[model samples]
Target: MPGESELATLLRDLKPMLAEEEHGFVTIPIGSGWPQGLVPVATFAETEGASVIALSSILDGIGLEYEEGWAKITIGATSALSAVGLTAKIAAALAETGISANIVAAYHHDHVFVPWARRDEAMAVLENLSKVQE
Candidate 1:
């Protein structure tokens, strides 16, 4: 609601909560049509030719099929919408360090999905950014 600058400031003010969400992940081929049943577990990669949805499995019927090598770090805040460029900025930061991030911007927060091995480092970088940024 605020804005990118405001969101950054807010994130800076709040105590960083570094937690991990790791579990099943699957990439399904529903073509141009979405699957009608089964629940997705953690993350899903749905596609119709080139159009794709690397979406969340929070409350869907899609079942998760894999169980290794994925992690999520939630940058919790609704205002994160304002932090658009900032997300890419942080992403670039992670990228420079070779940590791939798959960002999911939910209604209430922005979730960054990273490789399981680099999750801790990713969290540290983000948390540190929140702290040092004024």
Candidate 2:
């Protein structure tokens, strides 16, 4: 199915759901495999590093030092890459409340990573945004 592109529809219907796990982001050498039993929610290759986002426990278990307390918000819209303003809308809402958002757009959905301590507040902002008719 074609992804949604209309900004209004994207906001109104995009249910932002938070993943239950408390996550963290880390970077290790690209050639090394992830420590056993740890699954990353996302991973990326950078020129200087390989980045992984995974559960805090996994980071601790693996003996890799990492930044702690990140949370993911999965937007329930198959949004087209060309879709405009959705990130801005969500970011703006959070910004107004002094919360920062890190957004990742995948083929199937847009995920927002926020400070773990603020996940519930971020969800409330997104939920309220979804309730807006226009």
Candidate 3:
């Protein structure tokens, strides 16, 4: 099925859910292969290195230096890649409360990463957005 593209509908249906496992960010320098048995939820290649998001425990076990203590919030709505304003709206709402939001758009949905300690607050913000939009 095609994903939702209308901004209002996207906001109304953003059933944000907090993941149970804590994740972390790690960067592997160019020319270095990924750590053995490391399963990354997401990866991006840049000029300096390959950025990865994976479970905190897995990253620690591999002895990789990473910024840990992040909580992942997955937007339950399947938003289209062409959808606009969703990220901005989410970021703005979270920003109002000083919550840092790092949103990653995948083929079907958007995953938001926020500081572990503020996950509940972030979820509240997102839930409020949905209610207001409804």
Q: Residues 63-132, candidate 3, lDDT per residue (tens digit)?
A: 8878858999999999988888999999999999999999999999999999999999999999999999
Question: What stretches of model 3 exceed 4 Å from their correct place?
Answer: none
Question: What does candidate 1's lDDT look like per residue over 15-130, in tens digits?
Answer: 43455445334555555354565344334443533222333343133643443555767775454454546567668778888988777666556667788777888878887777
9-46, model 2: which lDDT tens digit per residue?
Answer: 99988888899988888887767766677688888899
Candidate 3: what lDDT? 0.93
**TM-score of every candidate:** 0.64, 0.91, 0.97
Question: Which candidate would rank higher by TM-score, 1 or 3?
Answer: 3
- Give all candidate RMSDs, comma-separated: 5.0, 1.5, 0.9
User: In candidate 1, which residue pairs clash?
Assistant: 4-82, 38-61, 38-62, 39-61, 39-62, 39-63, 40-62, 40-63
Question: What TM value does model 2 have?
Answer: 0.91
Ranking by lDDT: 3, 2, 1
Off by over 4 Å in 2: none
Residue 17: error of model 2 in Å?
0.7
Compared with the true structure, model 3 gives a TM-score of: 0.97
Which of the predicted structures, 1 or 3, would earn the higher lDDT when compared with the native? Answer: 3
